[model samples]
Target: MTLTLTALTSPPARVDLSPLVPETTRGRSAIEVAGTAIRCGRDRVGVGELFAVSGYGTDELVLRGELGRIDRIGAGMRGGRLRVEGSCGDHVGARMTGGEIVIDGDAGAFAGAELRGGLVRIEGSAGASAGAGYPGTRAGMSGGEIVIAGDAGQEAGAAMRRGLVAIGGRAGDGAGLRMLAGTVIALRGVGAEAGMGNKRGSIVSGRPLRPLPGYARAVRYRPPALALQLRRLRELGLEVPDAMLTGAWTRWAGDRLELSRGEILIFDEEEVAAG
Candidate 1:
């Protein structure tokens, strides 16, 4: 069974809808599911008051309408699938340990912050801190994968401890800020100061990127890891060019300010053209 929720009105303030995921709604009746409390502004309200809920007792959930103020849509989900047909607000899939969340439109800030496992795919752009850590925490996005088909705002993978974040479009400044571990692949250009303060991680840029002062170019070579990752991206329906899959990449290692194990790989245009 698949549950469907259609929002009747745009939320006035941030609404935490994490309580309505498959884990909590799987065995409940429509009335019970609708009665689930959601945080709206300073008050708690039944989901039935905000959206029309239909179907129940399933692991699949479909949500429609504009949810630009809905936060924590799939927080801590361990299994099942959630599909959003319209734009979603901040923290779309924060701390989800498993399952899948697909957003057909744009997502606001912290789209996948603190994710532990699972897959989150955004067909449109994402706001800042897409895979960042919670406030006061040392790590963000300990696991899972986030695929942004459009541009990503600043700090796309900030403080991520593990997992993968692939952006098919340009990434704003601070793409991998303070990243401890993980991989961030930006297909288009990346803004200044990417990989800042990174301790141990990999930032692969397919477009032009000026070397940051905190980094130092190490070498130029074709890494086997790039081929494997590109293949995975291709499986996700992302167009990974032949050159990118089999090209020499310039490796720059630094953010020497930290543990110094972090690396930034910039694709060599000349190699791309030759390929």
Candidate 2:
């Protein structure tokens, strides 16, 4: 049976639920799960004190309640599914090697930081540094996919080595700031300095981007590769407008101060004027 944890009340400090994943609780019973030590700010507490746990030792986990104060819901999981019924905490699926984590509501900062493999799908908006590297980390999200149905905060895919971060709505400043290599899809729009210092990644946008300093326009055409990626997004149940799926895009080679291999593809202004 799928394991379930229901929060008893709002926490005084952030509660860490990262230990409840399949790997850590593989052989643990419900009682052992209850006994699992979880951190709350500077102190440690037992899981049973804060949550009503049930059906232990399963790869599939369901968390219920307003989990915004909870942290690392699916950290370091190798496989399985984790579903959050309400708004979730930071690092929802950080460092997961494989599996899927679905957050039904908004997610906090660093939603999928340093993810290795797997998918983190948020049905609502996400906070800053959605797929970014930690303060001292070398790279962010080495591999994986993070799909947000609504807006995303600043530096959405910052310093990512490899992965896909798709934001369905507008993104904050520096959407793909300092990206190493990856694909960042900001559908509606993005704030200032969208692709600053990017090395070898792609930032795809539906709206016109503000003038980026280290960029030079390359070409304007509909890219077949982008259409394929749009199709994949549709398969994941995210909306892909017809114009977005089959529109002409203007490619700009960017971040000249860096490797200059990164590209930003904006929906062509000419195409929009013609339509």
Candidate 3:
């Protein structure tokens, strides 16, 4: 089943989408209705005043027209697929624990903030803190995966405890700041202070880096786990360059200020000759 949403007019106030039924096990069990329509909510306004809802099914949900103000499109979703055909506001998949979300356009700040499980793929760029922990929260993205096809803003994966984040384009400053455990791979160059104060995690970059003074150059070796990581990225529809998957990486361990278990792997050209 497919539920299509077309905006009738620009919403005067931010619409609250919590009232919409979800595809949870209990919700699907109770509601016999397969599809629903929603429109911009105004002061004392009903859904009929805004947009027309059509379709009768539960398998798919599609959103059309501009949605720059519709926040939390799929918040805490546990099942079903959500497709956003246009750009959306912040918190597209906040704390989502299951299902898949594909955004065809750019997303606002905190795109996948504190996602616990499931997969979120963004075909366009994302704003700051793409997969970082929420403010005052101890953990960020404890599970699941986030793939950004374009450049990302600051603090891409700050304080992440688990899961994988792959940025297909360049990443902004503080890419993986204070990460406890997880994997962050940037296919393009990462911003300055890529992994500052990281405790235990891996930050892999496809470009060279100006290693911090405290980070000593470790032995250059082909990481056995890199093959698996790249394979996972490929499965997510990210373009993994042949050079990256087949190249050797220069390992630099640091943030001596912390556990010193975190390391950054910079892909090196020497691997081709050594092979």
Best by lDDT: 1
Better of 1 and 3 by TM-score: 1
In model 3, pairs of residues that clash are: 1-57
Candidate 1 local lDDT, 1-275, one digit each (tens) = 47899998987777999887888888788888888889999999999988998887588899998788888889888999999998998998899999999999999999899999999999999999889886788889899999999999999899999999999888889988989999998888678899999999999898857767788878789899888997898877677889888778888898899988999998876633211
Off by over 4 Å in 3: 16-51, 270-275
TM-score of each: 0.96, 0.95, 0.87
- Kindly give the number of clashing pairs for every candidate: 0, 0, 1
> Model 3 residue 66 lDDT?
70
Regions of candidate 1 where Cα sits further than 4 Å from its true position: 271-275
Model 3 residue 89 CA deviation in Å: 0.9
lDDT of 2 by residue, 26-49 (tens): 666778888989999889999998
Across 130-236, the per-residue lDDT of candidate 3 in tens digits comes to: 88888888788888898999988998888888988888998888888888889888888688888887888788888777665546677677888987899889988
Model 2 misses residue 98 by how many Å?
1.0
Which candidate would rank higher by lDDT, 2 or 3?
2
